[model samples]
Target: MKAWALLGAPKNQWPSNIKAKLLAAKKSKDLIIGVDRGALLLEELGLTADLAVGDFDSLQKDELERIESKVSDIRYSLPEKDLTDSELIMRCAFCDYQVSHLAILGATGGRLDHFMSNLLMVLKPEFNPFAEKIELIDQQNSIKFYNAGKHTIYQIPDYNYFGVVTLTAVQHLNIAGAKYSLADFNGDYPISFSSNEFLSEKKPLELSLKKGTVAVIQSKDIDRFQNI
Candidate 1:
């Protein structure tokens, strides 16, 4: 499967520790697309992008010129829009790039509303089906939402902590191979049932769902994402 990552509004929001992971993904992926301010992060990281997207609203003139010169596609969006820059770029990737899996960075830490909106974006009908594949990753936690199905989650080495949360209403949930265990679980609003630590370094946690979609998050150190 192919992987792609988009960086958005990185500025002071970039996590120093996650830079290595970003670099590794860039080398392992088919393409890296930067959205608006994310282009700046790509440049700052000294990584060239295969594609760039945005109105160039958040970037300076020289930066914009530099990016446009390197990438084959520099798709632009209107400054005024119902969609955020990240959402716009994601739409582009789903259409043109046809990437099977996507991870987004520079998406958290800036604004509470923005962060939650981004997290909750996966709840959209158009986006939910891709949740099992589309992930939001940072230095600390890698989060994604999945619909009613069984999923085998592997270790990132960096993210050894695993948790499953009910985004909507879910029942008959089964969780195994963690510090805390659950069986035939039922969850409601504001209730996150399965938050467990990965005790077995050699094995991964297995999540089996019988009903609704869940928010799965894996973290090495949750605190790493604290300041954003």
Candidate 2:
């Protein structure tokens, strides 16, 4: 699948882990789009976007002009619009590029409001069916959703941690090949099952579902909670 990864410059610049993911995506000819200040981040990294989108609100006049002059492809959304730059990225990805999937970076690890909005934006019903294609990756984790099915989890190099979070109420959710195994495990809302590890070094992990949706997050970044 031809993937498009969007990087949003939300106050802070991209983290090392997130940068690696973007570079990895670029290797596969994944189209990269930047929103607002994110475009500047892309420029700072010596990377130019396939297309630049969103209002020029976050940048100075000189910066905006420089970007506009250099980037021939762009979609400038009005500042009066209801959608955020991140939303603009989603719109272009689905409505324009018609991409099967997208990976979004720099949406996390900043202002709480911006982070939450970028995250919850993917949960909209119009995009829910293709939610599998959208992921919000950061320094600490890579997260995405699965509606209801059996999925073979691929191994990401250096990804040593995982967690199962019930977005809605779920029953009969079975997770295999983990430090804490489960069978028909009922996960309640607001309850994030955390700090789990893969047990089998040979096979891929399997998650079987019975009802509702499950959000899985995997990470190789060391937990800051235990960084002593």
Q: Write the per-residue lDDT of candidate 2 for residues 10-78, one digit (tens) a residue.
A: 534344655666677678777888777777787876667777888878789999998888876799999
Give the Å error, residue 67, model 2. 1.7
**Where is the poorest 10-residue window by lDDT in model 2?**
5-14
Model 2 steric clash pairs = none
Error of 2 at 192 (Å): 0.7
RMSD of 1: 3.1
Please give the CA lDDT of all the candidate structures. 0.73, 0.74
Q: Give the top-scoring candidate (lDDT).
A: 2
lDDT of 1 by residue, 11-81 (tens): 45445565676688777865687777777677777777777877887777887888888878887888787
Error of 2 at 109 (Å): 1.2
Q: Each candidate: how many clashes? A: 0, 0
TM-score of each: 0.83, 0.83
